[model samples]
Target: MTSRSHSLRDAIEEQIAVGELRPGQHLDETELATRFGVSRTPIREALIQLASMGLVVIRPRRGAVVAEIAPQQLVEMFEVMAELEAMCGRLAARRMFTEEHAQLQAAHDACREAREAVDSDEYYYRNEAFHEQIYAGSHNAFLAEQARNLHRRLRPYRRLQLRVRDRVATSFSEHQEIVDAIVAGDGERTAALLRDHIMIQGQRFADLIASLAHLSNKAA
Candidate 1:
């Protein structure tokens, strides 16, 4: 995340955000270098970092391509994300300290500010902070690390859904439910709600994919 790498990342993420570098599209270093007004070194490094976040795949023969996120992968990730977050909530309920609880409250306040501003993207980022706060509050270093890795992997999809059909407001509501459960130390409710919140996205994605498959078959 140095100055140069940050610039490259911004350029790359812009392409992704605008749908220029779409799913399964190859990332040509020469073309990317030309686009970002830099050489191959920074582009390569940026691609590697993005790949680590599950955004791209760097292969030998074809180089990097935007990762093809399958419906099954989405469903699988939703399952894993639910379990990890639930684990965090359960542990946090049992182990959260005063300072950690205060941090969690601060993060929720950030989410509230984003909601008031009606900035969904900002809401999404701050929502991540809120979840990370709970994870760290769990006091299980290993579980926190695992949840973080999964969270990063799901970032792109999560952001995409945030812009879909008033999902931002819906997400805020879910966060409120989670916070209540955490404060009450209601482990069972926390786990179930987290699972439902995550699995709902998977169900939506499945329906979307199903419609696409039908349309493709009809066109064929």
Candidate 2:
């Protein structure tokens, strides 16, 4: 992507994050171009990127709109994602090579840097790389592929999880535990930690649902 498209993409994502562009809200290329002082071409490219990330839905005739997921469906997807990630952690603990372990540590360090900077958006991107390292470390091609597919589908919702109050710090601490377990070659401990790490629980789940509801209402 060109610099224009990259900037436009970040602009649009920020708009969505701030509820300026709400779920199910139609995106007009011409209007976005006008608002951003860019042409339709870059706007279109940015929208495509958003669609690929599951942030927006692109229809044949209806154009692009912010993607919407029912709360129950969102929970279900997260549950599945949790299981997939747990599996990756388990396999990674058993199968990761020396070089892969080093890479995973590097990703974790990058996440720590993002956390130190208190940049949730930066942490969000780095968190993805951190998980990708786990998937690759799993050393199971089919499992990694399946995990990646679900991971992509849950990308937007996962990103929203970070928006919860103080979630970044808590998540980083959990990541540290997970990394320690993996490095210690404790497959069971790693799997259990990872399962809890990604699985939204009592209050967190409630907060996530409320946040999603707020976004949906604002969009409506």
Candidate 3:
């Protein structure tokens, strides 16, 4: 896609992630075109890309809107995502090359800077890169692809969770331990840490739901 399309996609994705655009809110292409001072073609392209990422839904008669996933279904997706990430960590611990290890460390360092800045949005993007390094280190193409696909689907919810109080700091701390485990070639430990890092349960789940409800209320 063109740079304009990518820019529009990221802008809309951020709005949805931060709850500025609530679930099921209509995403009219014409309005988006006017709002962004772009042509409808770019707006439509951006919406289509977002739809592929599970952040938007395109309907036959209704055009497009923000995707609305049921709470229970969201939980289920997180559960699977956690497992996929854990597996990636496990394999990465044993399989990563020396160069891959260095790259992972660099990604983690970037995340640390984001955390120190206390910018949740920056940290979220850095954190994604850190996890993706592990996925690449897994040395299993199919597994890596599956993890990436699910990760994209869960992007909005995952990004939303980081906005919770001190979540970015906590996430960085977790990443520290995860990196240590993988570097030490402790597959099981890495797996466990990754699972805990990605899993949304207990209070984390509650925080996510409350945030979503707040956004829905605001939209209403």
Candidate 4:
């Protein structure tokens, strides 16, 4: 991707992730081009890229809009994400090198700082870094690529999950447990923790939905 298209993609994705661009919300090519000070060509390219990433939809006659995932689809996506994360954790626990472990530790420390400051956005980015480190530590390049692709697709929903009451602190604690298990080379324990960490079922799912609704209301 060209630098302009890449930046435009990032900007649009950020808006969607933060709920500024609601699901099914229309994305006017000309408006976005004007807003971003770029030509319609780059905007169209960015929308096409986002569509491939499952973050946007391109209809034959209606143009592009943010992707609207159904609740069932959301559950299914999270289910798959949980398993992928578990697989990564398992491999990472066994295959992680000394330097990778050190990097994971540092990322964990940053998460702790974000939690201490009660900074959900900071925690969100650090949390992403922490998980990406685990994916990299897995040492299976193909598996890591698949896992990262799914991670990107679920980025918005996962980020919204952090907005649930007290979830940031709870997530940080879980990260601590995961870090300890990985450092001890306990593959099974790390895998189990990772699965639980990403799977938002029952009350957790309800809570995530509620948080998203609250954010949507505010955005409106």
| lDDT (Cα atoms) of all candidates against the true structure | 0.78, 0.87, 0.91, 0.92
Give TM-scores for every candidate, taking all chains together and pairing residue i with residue i: 0.81, 0.77, 0.89, 0.97
Cα distance off (Å), candidate 4, residue 219 = 4.2
**Which portions of model 1 miss their true places by more than 4 Å?**
1-20, 35-37, 201-203, 206-220
lDDT, residue 199, candidate 1: 70
User: What ranking of all candidate models by TM-score puts the best one first?
Assistant: 4, 3, 1, 2
List model 2 lDDT by residue over 76-147, tens digit each. Answer: 888888899999999999999888889999999999999999998889989999999999999899999988
> Candidate 4, residues 59-178: lDDT per residue as tens digits?
998899999888889999999999999999999999999989999999999999999999988899999999999999999998899899899888889988998889999999999999
Deviation from truth (RMSD, Å), model 4? 1.1
Compute the lDDT for candidate 4: 0.92
Best candidate, lDDT: 4
RMSD to native, candidate 2: 3.7
Clash pairs for candidate 1: none
Give candidate 4's error at residue 181 in angstroms.
0.7
Q: What 10-residue stretch in candidate 2 is worst by lDDT?
A: 14-23
Give candidate 4's error at residue 32 in angstroms.
0.7
Clashes of 1: 0
Shift of residue 13 alpha carbon in model 4, Å: 1.4
- Per-residue lDDT of 4-121 in model 3, one digit per residue for the tens? 9999998998788766777889988999999899999989999999998888999998899899999999999999999999999999999998899999999999999998898998
